[model samples]
Target: MSWSEACHLDRSLLSLEHFFSIPPDYAQTLTGGLTNRCWKIVTTDNKSFVWRPATHITKAFSISRFQEYQILSAIESSHLSPTAIHINDQGLLVDWIEGESLTDSLSFDSLLQTMIKIHDLDTQRLPLAPFNYTARVDHYWMLLSDEHKVPAFAEIYNRWRTAPNLADVGLSLCHFDLAGYNMVKTEQGNKVIDWEYAALADPRLDLTLSIDVMDEKPLEAVYRYCQLRGIEGVDDWVEGVLAWKPRATMMAMLWYLLAYQLWGDEQYLTQAEKLQQAFCS
Candidate 1:
């Protein structure tokens, strides 16, 4: 289902009892996520909580709510994630993590250190499928014909299809979409949020994706992280990781094409053109 339809379904499913036994005194809207509606709830007792209604698309990509509860429960013990309070059949409630997003201002060393800490956490791996950006691009091309997204993307898509084997790379529990927007900078330290796409995958992919969205200084930190991980042949790995961007860009283009169809936004077409040019260049 579409995001709008999923949101309507969420609104229909939510009730006062879903979050708290008693009614909440105040509800504050939180933005950033494209998939779900997030709200900060303040109970009559002055306790703070976060309420998130899962989107239909996200439900396909993420672990079940119960599984998410278990995973978060284990990870929180290491103090890497926020504590999940309750997750019912309809929604989830967790501690409202307060902080700024690690957008442009976060230092490279700080980001790399934070990632290493998360990678070093000893939580048992949860049962989630690996994220294959190549496969996802192929699926998008199959599902939506060249008529949908820019046809030029297919060349980059094919180039990455036969890219070097990353199977020998190290695997760990990764926040699959660890971009600047998802990181929450707390007073104590950085706290990563949005566990929906969290899974066990090549740590290099996460590092690559994170650095792609960071400033030049953080790119250097990414190289440092690679060295500390004993990853030799930095040039080859950088090539492999950089190849991932075209595949990712293709995936984003598919989403925008679909969004444009629904919302009548020509800007989506404009963005897809830009990504297509970047992929080709």
Candidate 2:
């Protein structure tokens, strides 16, 4: 069953008997998700699952449910992410990882190791799609309104759109969002959620995004990642990540700008303005 039919704002569940043989006896809305609506469901049999319903803005944010399923399946044996139990046009259902959010508790070393493991995974057999940077950014830019499209934004877009895509090298399955908040420390281990932005891309891009989200220095993190992975010339890789830093920032700015236009959230606009100011200055 879809979100509209299965869930209600009154915290009541509808006919979920067909969705999961034994309808869930309990359901709770999980807040703090910026992109989609999420619910934690428990069936009479005591099985728990997290349900993320598809929305009109899923594509607007460059998320691919199909790719998410494939990536999860490819890495299921590694136990780095949740198991994708089921997916349809409506939404995705996965095993509920029972653990507290480890945003503050998770160490940088642990986070870096997780990134290494994900990069080392064998994804050759999976039909994973590459993250086309230009196309994706162009789509986001087009979604912005005229008033929001200032000359500064146009210049930033032109610079990044023409710059070389540093992420085209050393391709691997990269979790675009490796922030501590996206991870949960379970009894089994740290399990990462939100595979919507995951794709086959440069490992450096993953490292850059992770360090930036954690508010750590990019140069130091790059050096650590290179040392752990054992690369010959560390300087070159550092340069690549440094160059990708602004590009990553640009992508976030465009996304926030577009989100502001669609959702009319003042916070989103503020974030967009902050990024623009930082980039322009």
The top-ranked prediction according to TM-score is 2
Tens digits of per-residue lDDT, candidate 2, 1-281, equal 33443465522234333677655667777876777677888777888888776667787887777777877887899999999988776667788898989878888888998888888888796796677788888989988889988998888887886445453456888989887789998888888998888898777777888888888888888888878877767877788888878888898899889888878999999998898899867
The collision pairs in model 2 are none
Per-residue CA lDDT of candidate 1, range 1-281, in tens?
Answer: 33234335457235436445666666766787755567777767888777766555445333355666666877876676779988776667788878887866777667677777777776454555555655555554565545664447556556655434653555677776666677788887788787765666667667766776673433465578877766667765566566555555556666555555445669867876776677657
Alpha-carbon error at 244 in model 2, in Å?
Answer: 0.6
Candidate 2 accuracy as lDDT: 0.80
TM-score of 2: 0.92
Score residue 156 of candidate 1 by CA lDDT.
Answer: 56
Candidate with top lDDT is: 2
